[model samples]
Target chain A: MAVPPTTSRTAAELATQPACWRRAADAVPATEGLPRPGERVAVTGCGTSWFMAQAYAALREAAGEGETDAFAASEFPTARRYDRVVAITRSGTTTEVLDLLAALRGTAPLLALTADPATPVRDAADALAVLDWADEESVVQTRFATTALALLRAALPGGREAVLRAADEAATAVAEPLPAALLSASQWSFLGRGWAYGVAQEAALKMREAAGAWTEAYPSMEYRHGPVAIAGAGRVTWAFGPVPGGLEEAVTAAGGTFVHAPSDPLAELVRAQRVAVAVAEARGLDPDRPRGLTRSVVLGV
Target chain B: MAVPPTTSRTAAELATQPACWRRAADAVPATEGLPRPGERVAVTGCGTSWFMAQAYAALREAAGEGETDAFAASEFPTARRYDRVVAITRSGTTTEVLDLLAALRGTAPLLALTADPATPVRDAADALAVLDWADEESVVQTRFATTALALLRAALPGGREAVLRAADEAATAVAEPLPAALLSASQWSFLGRGWAYGVAQEAALKMREAAGAWTEAYPSMEYRHGPVAIAGAGRVTWAFGPVPGGLEEAVTAAGGTFVHAPSDPLAELVRAQRVAVAVAEARGLDPDRPRGLTRSVVLGV
Candidate 1:
């Protein structure tokens, strides 16, 4: 008899990241409602999606696309005028995103990238770019978040090559073993710079959601401010993208392990997801149902 | 023999916050380089000042004072054009702030708000607003951060009254005895909404910097996403502004203490500063000089 697979819904979802990213990136050319070059843009989301929005905003601005700002959907500045507003929601049913989309209907053209196309966002958004293939059954998001960011990344100049490289890296990361330091660390700090800061934030969130882990995220430069005080013995500080000068040495001096790889930041995030799942299994928690969370934050019924 | 004063420099600095706020609010008219109404403004700073910038930016936009954005000094976008750029550096010598000020000399009108008037920023920025009276002897910021924010707040519509009211509340908060629960919490999570989100971030920073406490911060609404997974016994979640609906009950359900005060957010920040000092004293640490930190981050000096 074949051994029953112990893989959780989240682990299965995590495994499909490379393929999902490739599909999303490949579909960007035919997709509509992406912000045009030189158009001022604002991106909004909540939770995991918010981090993706931040990454996309930083990536877009760094690409010389235009000035872009990212905000939590609930905190979206209504007074500010932007040429385009992009909303990222995995479930297409978060109350805050829907409310913002409805509020912005008359003022700014709104584009929504969601995993589910048959939901209320279809009517709320002015334009919809649905990634039905990336939708997940797990409560803790994995593929959908990366797929949304991949779609946005692919829309920018030289974005396709970056996405393809990240996808290739994700494939290798999925099969590789996680570092022993990453498996049972007492605490973790995820650090990133520019666009990668969003990836760092997502990595921290994944640990919290999947394994009830005490994790934190910060801009690589900001990590030195106060958070580094906690970086001693049995803790890990992982950086996405380029490490700031002297950071690794500082963490080492504080007796904390520092992890970095040459892989693309998106691929780095895939490895983080695997760690989250592994940690969850070690703790006897089910990644498919993260404690005290829902698939979507649908407030007020 | 007379008993020597044991009051920490941070405590003394904290004690003067209400007065500093009043002075800064009253001095707004004479304070040049304040961002004007109907101007697109961006504020930049590092650490505590960065949190204050976020507070000011959100407050500015909420006041219908045109679009405003806040960024970490190291992360400021040179590609984006703004009508005005405000850099907050208490020492006026931070490498990142000085670099940005020098780089933005001609492109956009630059404003440097600092406690020190005689510094390189004097040569770098086009305009200067000095709050030398609020400058602190302690390495951890208290008065200057609040005072600078007061100046920014007082420049907005109906701002003086708000600042004056907050000063009065600060006076009360400064005198009151802190709750016993706040003194011994093993871990903390600070939450805030809108402009108060910045206050939450600062509160968490103060705990970490002053007492070596493990703390985290997030927009109040975003806390439910994943961070709350670790919010159990001996952990505290404090909200600077109005508690989100059902959040208090949820945190309580998770066996965590929730703290919310009726005082203005700025006044609430004063109480948090007191907690920082008390925690530092209990841990036999000096708030006057945080570990691995200088008054200003002067890199490569």
Candidate 2:
């Protein structure tokens, strides 16, 4: 397959991920309303933001900071009590996140982690951690979500040292040539484990939102349980982190291509973002303004 | 799509769900080591059993039971501590579940919920809850999972009354004719929220395992986030619980058929099981013996 032209805003936004990661990681100490150590926390967001929240929750839990849960903004559990609720919205205007923050205002210490603190979430949340530098104009989010996750990752046990290393790796990921097969596969399955599972889910979302592709995501080990049944010719199974011992063999036996990048999972995510844009360009679609979507899902707008 | 013959072992197993429900619900009172009221619990399983754990966790939490978490057996966190760990595995010998149980044997109260208590789980878990009658010969599980969940549900706040009601609904579900479109669709998406979200995930797994179909699952509201981009003619989006008001319209606008059944979510799950078999038969496959699958995924078997 020819290298498709990547001229869209999404392409440019995605390419800046490395710089965004570094900046976000540096801003972590200054970010207000962040979940404190030992607090029981629940994070909520929509679309790409939700996937990022999942990554942050897993990272926090794995770091042994506290019990952290992630939910799609609309599906936030009202019955469960948490010490703090963090809402992630790139535009800071998604109705579900705003409504949830509004509803939980008095019940919990509501914190808004968003690209724009000046938006409606200002009144909805008790406090704000603004990342306006990572905000995007593209309907398909690329840098903002990862930047937010990078910031959150810096707050974990490994802190700035780990995120800085990831940013350095991402610098290479952004400039590298993608696997040609990824551009032509008819279907894609992205798999990971722990925090990487959320990255895998975000990778699949980028394929669907930017390229209108058939894509699915799962915890790497869970793929063989049933989903491997769909892995055949013209399909690709991409693993974000360490490839499970026999997964490559399983996918190969099923006549599917398997991809595993040794890059940091966040860095692998950057490469996947590039593939989304290239595939979109090849399909004659605009990754900047995806069909049947808007910059922010402001319902009834 | 002419009514595909349903003579497989999975078909017979699924048909007995209502009876299984009644027996499991009644047996709940006699079951050993069930999570007590206000106890923090974690449910772990693999494949179909894992999805059931998710449903049970959500249901328990919604009933205002103490915090309940679900994890795939392989993904169970070693860092987290719970009052009780519930392992759901029909085979009673899955390596990951057994490993988890063995690891937690003394740390927490270990409860094994399985088809046959005589298996390795008897030694691995501190307590055993047997439902051997619901054991299945088919690789594609239909009855064992629901029956196990029914047992768990009986311990929650509405208990037996609600479960027996759902069993009655399942009685109708097993006998109803599946939608013709479901049999012919080239792709499928199952959508649900909370506990039902897990059921939807299982529904999608059923499609892929039984028919080698292109299928996906998501939180109903999250569907529009990105997966909706895959919806188009020859695809079906089925909802287990309430269809989010505009979801049907959105799926319709994307040129896909939408299915929403008013039956209890468990009952709706039974109907999905039947559709899996029907679609498998239509594609010259057998649901009882899905490709690349075994009755028990005993590693290195």
Q: Which candidate is the best by TM-score?
A: 2
Every candidate's DockQ is 0.56, 0.64
TM-score of every model?
0.96, 0.96
Candidate 1, A216-299: lDDT as tens digits? 898998787667766778999999999888889788988899999978999999999988888888878888877778888877
Q: In candidate 2, residue A239 scores what lDDT?
A: 98
**Worst window of 10 by summed lDDT in candidate 1 chain B:** B1-10
Please give, as one word, the docking class of candidate 1: medium
User: What is the per-residue lDDT of model 1 for residues B1-301, given as tens digits with 9 covering 90 to 100?
Assistant: 1112447888888899989999998899897778888999999998888999999999999988888899988888988889999998899898888888888889889998999999998999988999999998788888898899999998899999999999999999988888878888888899999999999899888988888787889999888876777688888999998888878877899899999997899999898888877887777887786766667777664
A1-301 per-residue lDDT for model 2 (tens digits)? 6676667889888888889889988897787778889999999999888999999898898888898999999888777889999888888788888888877889889888788877898888888878888888888888889988988898777868888888899889888777788988999999999889999999999998889888889998888787888888889999998877788988999899999978789999988888888898888888887767767776663
Q: Estimate every model's Cα lDDT from 0 to 1.
A: 0.88, 0.87
TM-score of structure candidate 1: 0.96
